[model samples]
Target chain A: MTRRIFGVRTLGLLGLGLLLVGSYFGLFVAPAERYMGQVQRIMYVHVPCAWIAMVCYTAAFVFAVIGLWNGKPRWDARTTGAIEVGAVLNALLLVQGSIWARATWGVWWDWDVRLTTSLVMLLLFAGVLALRSFVDDSDRRATWTAVATIVAFVDVPLVYFCVRWWRSLHQTQSTPETVSPAMVLPLRLNAIAILLIAIWLIAQRAKLERERLRKEQVDEPARVTAGLEVTDA
Target chain B: MSQERKRRRLLAVVALLIAGGVMAYLAFGGIGENLVYYWSPTELREAGPRAFGASVRLGGLVEPGSIDRQADGLTMRFAVTDGEASVPVVAETVPPAMFREGIGVVVEGTMLRDGHFQTQRLMVKHDNQYRAPEDFKPEDMKELMKSLQFEETGT
Candidate 1:
C-alpha cells in the first residue's frame, strides 16, 4: 500500500512539474491573442481540462463495458474512479468555459447547442455517480452503474458534434489549420500535463476503492456471524 | 443459475433496451427541432414570416461604417453581412470589446416585422490566430519582464 502511494505521489509530482512548466510557457512565452489579449491564456487550462474530462469519461465507458462483460470488481472500481474524476473535471470545464464565455461572448452562459449538450453530458454522468452511492450491494451497484454509464455515454458523441450539427455560438474544434505553431505548443504541453494529473488521480482513487472493497470483504463474514448470533439469541 | 434468475436478467435487459430507445428518440427529436437555432440572412429571408418574432441567432461579419450608437451609449445599431446578404441589427447592450467592423459576430434576438433584428446579446467570434499585436516589438517584452520582476519584488 505504501509503495502504491509512493508511486502515485511520484506521478502526481511529475504532473505538477509539467503543469508549472506548461503554465510558464502558456502565460509568458506564448504570444497574446490578437483579439482576446491576455484573457486567451485561459484557453491553455480550459481546453486541457475539457479534453481530459472527455478522455476520462471515455475511459469510464470502457471500464463499464469490461466490468459488465467480466463482472470484475477491479473494472468496476476503475469505472467509479474515472467517473468521479471526469465529473470533477467536467465541472471545472464548465466554470472555465463560463469565464471564457464572459470574456469573449459577452455572456456567462448561453443555451447554444454545444454548451447545452456538454452540460447534459456532465449531468448524466453526475446522475450515474449519485445512483452508485445510493445502492449498497457491491455487485448490484456495479451492474447498475455499468448500465447507467453505457446509457450516459450516448451523450459523448453529441457533445463533440454539437458545434458541427447546429448553429452554435461556441467556436468549432481547434486544429492545425486553425491554431498557430506557438499557440499549439503550450496547448499540447498543458494537455499532456493535465492528462498525467488525471491518470494519477484516477489511479489513486481506484486504489482507495479497492482497499475499501477489501475491508468490506473482511467484515462480511463477521457481519454474518453476528447476525446469526442475534437470531439464535 | 435458477430459472427465476434467468427470467429476471432477461427482463432487466429488455427494460434497459426500451429505456435507451426512448432516451435516444427524445434526444434526437429535441435536436431536430432546435437544429437551426440561428439563421443566416439568406436563410432568414427564405424563411420570411416564419422567422419573424421568433428568437434566433444571426451570425455574419459586421459591415464597416454601419455601426451607429444611439443617443444612449448602451444602445447600438449595426448591419451584419454575410457578403451575400445583410441584416440590420439593433442591440440593447454594449458590444463586446472585440466587436468591430469586418469581424465575425453572432447576435441573438428576434426578427422584427420591419426587417430588423432586435438583439439583447452580442458575441464576437475571434479567429484562431494567436499572435502579438503588430505594434508589439521584441524590445517591449524586455521592459515587460522587468516590470513584472519589479512588481514581484514589491519595489
Candidate 2:
C-alpha cells in the first residue's frame, strides 16, 4: 500500500519547485501591470487557487457519482478528500480576492452576482462537510456525503460562468489569448503547480480515510458480513 | 429487490424533473430580469424615467477630462461613458486610489430627474488583461529609487 501511494511524494516536490519559480517570475521577472502596477502580482496566487478549487470540486463531483453508483467506500473516501481540499482552497481564494478587491475595487466585499454566488458555493459545500460529521454509520455517512456533494457541486459552474453570463464588477475569464505571454507564463505555471499539489493532498487525505474505514470494518465484524470490506485497502 | 429498484428509479426521475425545471427557469427570462449585476451607462440611460431616483449601480469607463472636484472637497462630478453614451455623475464620497480617467468604474447611487447620477459608493473596475507598462522609462525608475531612498534616510 505504501509503495502504491509513494508517487504522491514526487508530486509534492515538483509542485513546490514550480510554485517557487512561478512566484519568482510573477513577482520579479514579470513587469508590474501598466495600470495596477505592483498590486496585480496577486493574480499569481489568486487565479490558481480559484481554478484549482473548482477543479477539486469537479473531481469530488465525479467521485460522488461513482460513490453513489457503486456504493463503494473507496469512492466515498476520494470524494471526501477532494471536497476537503477544495473547500480549503475555496476559502483561500475568497481571502485573496478580498485583498485584491481592497487594493483595486476599493471595497473588501460586495454583493455582486459573481461574488455572491462564490460565497454561496463555499457555504453549500462546507454545509455538506458539516452534514457528514453528524452521521456515524459508515455506509449511511458515505451515502449522505455523496448525495450532498452532488447537490453542492451544482454551484461550482454557476460561480465560474456568472461573470460572463451577467454584468459583473469581476472581470471575465483571462485566457492566454487575452493576456500577454509574460503574464500568462506565471499564471500557467502556478495553475499547473497548484493542480499537482491539490492532487497530492487529495491522495493523502483519501488514504487516511481508507485506513479509518478499514478500522471501522475490523471493529464492527458483524457489519462486514456482506463481504464488502474495502478490497483496495 | 425489484420493489427497491422501482423506488430508486422513481427517485431518479423526480430529481431529473427538478433539474429540468431549474434549467427552464434560468433560460426563459431569469438572466435578463434577475441576474443583471449592474447596468452600463447606455443601459441606464435607456432606462430613462424608470431609472429616476431608483437605487442602481452604473458601470462604465470614466471619460477623460470629465472629473470635476467640487470646491467643498466632499463632492466629485464626472461623466461615466460606455463609448456610445455618457452619464454625468455626482459622487458624495472619495473614489478609490485606482480610480482615474479611462479606468472602468462602478458607482452605486440614485439617478436624479436632472440626469445626474448621485453616488456615495465609487468602485474601480479592473480588466483581466495584464501587461507591463510599454512606455515605462528607465529615468522614471531612477527617480523612483531616489524618492524611495529619500523617504528612507530622511536626508
Candidate 3:
C-alpha cells in the first residue's frame, strides 16, 4: 500500500511539474496571434486535450490486450481505469474544441469530418464501458473488451484524417515547421504536460482498483482456496 | 516452459499483429485523408499563378459595387479583390448569412479550365471583436468613462 501510494504521488508531482512549465511558456512567453489576438491562447488547452486523449486510449488498448492474453487481474484493472480517464478527457477535448471554434469560426458545431470522427470515438468507448457492466465472468469480459478496444483503435487515425478526406474548414495541424518557434515550444510543452497528467490519472485510478481487488481477495475465502488448489494441482 | 505461459505469449503476439496491421494501413496506406484546409488571402494569391486549372481557395475583401444579385438575391456574382489582384466569382449556391459586399470572404472553387472563377461555396470571414451593450450608446459610454476618471495617456 505504501509503495502504491508513493508511485501515485511521484506521478502526480511529475504531472504538476510538466503543467507548470507548460503554462509558464504558453501563457506568458508566447507571442499573441497576428489575426485572432488573445483568443489563440485556446489552442494551448484544446490541442493538448485532444492529443492526450488519443494517447490515453492507445495505452488503454494496449493494457486491454495484455489483460486478455494473460488473464491478469492487474492488467484488467489498469485497462478499465485508463478507459475511464480517456473518456473524460475525450469529452473535455470536445467541449474545448467547440468553445475554440465558436470564438474563431463563429459557429459552435458543424458536421465536419474531424468533429464527426471524434464523436464516433466517444460513443465507441462509451459502449466499451457499458459492455463492461453487463459481463460477470472476468476472463470473458476482458477478452471481449480487448477485442472492442482493438476495433475502436482503428478510428483514431481515421478521426485525425477526416478533415483532409472531406472538404472541411477547420484548421490544419500546427507543426514545428508551420508554427513560429516561440509558439511551438509552448504548444509542445502543453501537449507533453497533458500526456503526463493523463498517465498520472490512470496510475491513480489503477492503484485504487488494485486496492479494491486486494480487499476482495482477502475477504473471499472461496476464491483464495480455489486459486491455491489450482496452483497445487 | 509452462503451457499457460506459452499460450499467453502466443495470444499477445497475435494481438500485436492485429494492432500493427490496422495502424500500418491507416497511417501509411492513404486510408486516412482527414485534413482541414486553412488558407489566407495572401496564400491564395501566391498560389494563383501556379495553381492553373486546379481547385483551390480564394479569399479576399469583396469589392464594393461588384456584387450582382440574380432574380433571387441568394444567387449572386461578386468580385473578390486583394487590392492588387481581383477574380470574378459566381456563387452557384447561396451566400452565407453574414456575407456582405464589403466584408472579407473566402470562396472554394477552381480558377476554371478558362479564367473565370466559379465557386461551390461562399463563406464569410468573421471578425473577433465584442462591445458591451452599455457601450452601444455613445453618450452613456462618455459618461461612464468620465465617472471612471480616465484620461487619454497617448496620442
Number of the top-ranking candidate, with DockQ as the measure:
2
Per-residue CA lDDT of model 3 for A117-213, tens digit only, reads 7988899989888997787555456666776777777777777765435434454454565455677777778887777777778877877666655
Q: In candidate 3, how many clashes are counted? A: 7
Which is better, 1 or 2, measured by DockQ?
A: 2
Q: Measured with DockQ on alpha carbons, how good is candidate 2?
A: 0.28
Model 1 lDDT tens row, A86-135: 98989999999999888877889888777998899899999998999898
Q: For model 3, report DockQ.
A: 0.09
lDDT leader: 2
Identify the leading candidate in terms of TM-score: 2
Candidate 2 per-residue lDDT, tens place, A86-176, comes to 9999999999999999888988999977789889988988998899889878877887787777767767877887665566778778777
Give the TM-score (vs. native) of candidate 2.
Answer: 0.87
Model 1 deviation from native, Cα RMSD in Å = 10.1
Off by over 4 Å in 3: A215-233, B1-155
Per-candidate DockQ values are: 0.21, 0.28, 0.09
Off by over 4 Å in 1: A222-233, B1-34, B127-129, B134-155
